[model samples]
Target: MKRRDAYLKLTRHNGRAGTHGTYNPKHNDRSFNLANSEHIDPERAKGNIYWDCFYGFRSALAPQDPDDLAATFSEVERQFYESRYSNFVESQNERNAKIRHTERNRSIPDLLSSRKTCPEETIYQLGTLDEHASGEVLLAVVTEFIEEFKARFGDHVHVLDWALHLDESTPHIHERHVFDCENKHGEVAPQQEKALEALGFELPDPGKPLSRRNNRKITFDTACRKMLFEIAKRHGLELEEEAEYGNREYLEKQDFILAKQKEQLAAQQNKLDELTLKVNDMETLIDEVSAAAYDKAVEVVTDVVRTETRKEDMRMIEDTKKWVLSPERKAPQSTREYTAKHLDSVLGQVPQDHADHRCPLAGEAPEAGSPAERQGADQGKSTGFCSATAEPLAGRADPTKAICAAYRRKIRKLFSIIVRGDVY
Candidate 1:
């Protein structure tokens, strides 16, 4: 549920300084009259003026009884001036360098830096009574309300000037004060904590660390509302209290947002850590995947080579069978003649116009006049893969034996690499 709005408003202004720079009673007086619409005072113009004092029952927030208001203002104003606090205030200001100590004191040095004597003053409306009512109704209610407040409040707080202002947008009492800022034993109290307890009101818990700081302001604002509420009850007024203290709600919401932001930051950090761990293992993961792929590649290449080798071996065997099964073996000729016949068979399979597409093999190339080159073959010319022997099987009728041996040697060399797991 939404909280009801506040009807009473207590405000403060330090009387130490005026709009120009320093404290000036004339400046305060002008402001007071302007606020209360007393510059063209209606009652004073009629010559049937009700009172001759700064304040009276007639000068209340809503003066219903002129006699009573005049009397109250007279009594309070008389007591205020009789306090004889001006000498103390003037001397104190001089000592603090706020003003010159004497008319002819040019040679004297200041004891302290200039400062206004009173630092703060306070004021507020009694309740919402001014909103719904005017004149005597407001005056009567406010008078009773102030009486209750004074009876319950501290004595160290001295009222200097007071007036009920009906000329404002809403009626409120303007009160000036000099907080007797020292404790009972004559030592200064921080933020007037001990001084405010002059009536034996409950002392604030010292355990609250901020009692001297922010809580000091909050505590007083709370106390003002409490006092008004209690008094408004006796007057049958319907003032309500707002739930929020000035700026308190905004500050609390900011704290909550800040806490959530911190949590999100922590969560993001955790996610980053997990990602970092994964990145650290990336090299190992890569090696594992690479090893599996290499094994599969070796298996595929070996199977393909073996299948081609089998077909080549069968053809070579068929060619050699013609030579070994022939009756010409019983009348074998010289090795050179047999080699020449063997070369013819192999050359027949090669295109006659493609002689320049030379077959190259391993080892040094034969010299121009050597037997290998003479038969249209060379060595040490790269074929992109491992070199094979291409030694003049041309013009040799027994080419089958040499071709078969070459095939076996190449197959064996490839198989050994794959079997030993060294292909990669």
Candidate 2:
């Protein structure tokens, strides 16, 4: 979509930069006739479409009264100088440095070098009214651009005064703003609040190129060119490309946004990977701890069994269990006989007697001569084989039983110790 030649030029002036193009608000009043062009009749367009001016910050818009153009310039000029001087004083105190002219000798009169030269104003000439644009449309585009600039930098950087010069050779705007420099002669008055610094559109040092290939400075002229191009494109006006915009000129808006999103996605992926690794580490630690706890419990139970039974007796009991349960053994007539026989077999085999036995009701094996022992000793059937009781004891009723009504319980108590030891 090719359009017209969109041109933007900025003229910066100060006390040091020769006063030929220096801007003064009083200049408008002195040359009041020249403020408006010969095309528009001043008498007819006096208060209506003659000139539209906006002063002060963009947020707090201060419209100039049509009846008094002189008053508007006077007020803004005073405030601009005042704010600029106040800011200059603060900067000087903070840095505590003096502006010295190394090239100029002390004997030579360098009057302005010692003092501040701030409250600098820049004159802007946007694209001229092209063939496609009417006077009204061109002014509207200029107004939109002014508003955009203010919104972009208004909070931090102050726009003291602004106006559209409709009577000029082409439709253009003149805005005077102060910055982080020193005072300009005695012409500056201290306004209450001064801006911190210009946010965007920083102008390079005077005499430097607007768009330098080597230097990466984004200057005010460059910003204006971009703004003009965009506005022209939107208004469907023709745009003549500048030959020296360099690489930055070819950059597209969509490409910039996509690049930013790509960066964000990569950062997010890195964060997710970090979290996943932490979670995996935690899971591995938990599994190791659980395995350790289980192994510790098994070890504790095995230790208890070793303490209760000697190695020899344990070996005998294991052999007897395997033999008794074997299909070929034809295990005792019933569970009662089986219990008696198994207990007798295990107790008689251990050399130390009953290392695994502990019974409160039956004490010390009945002195080794009790009738219970006499019966087993005389019959040669078992050792201490009690015949009075055959009933199973309190602990293992589920796996064993007794018989012979009278001797069942006594038999049960004798074998009860043997059964208890097997559990551990």
Best candidate according to lDDT: 2
User: How would you encode candidate 1's per-residue C-alpha lDDT over 84-106 as one tens digit per residue?
Assistant: 34334444456557455455232
lDDT of 2 by residue, 260-359 (tens): 6888999999999999999999999998997787566445533433323233233333333444344453434465356546666655644454444422
**Model 1 — TM-score against the truth?**
0.36
Among the numbered candidates, top TM-score falls to: 1
Candidate 1, residue 256: the lDDT equals 65
C-alpha RMSD of each candidate structure in angstroms: 18.1, 22.4
All candidates: TM-score: 0.36, 0.35
Name model 1 segments beyond 4 Å from true.
Answer: 1-120, 126-132, 181-191, 201-205, 208-220, 244-424
- TM for candidate 2 is 0.35
The per-model lDDT (C-alpha) reads 0.42, 0.43
Given candidate 2, what's the lDDT at residue 231? Answer: 74
Model 2 has an lDDT value of: 0.43
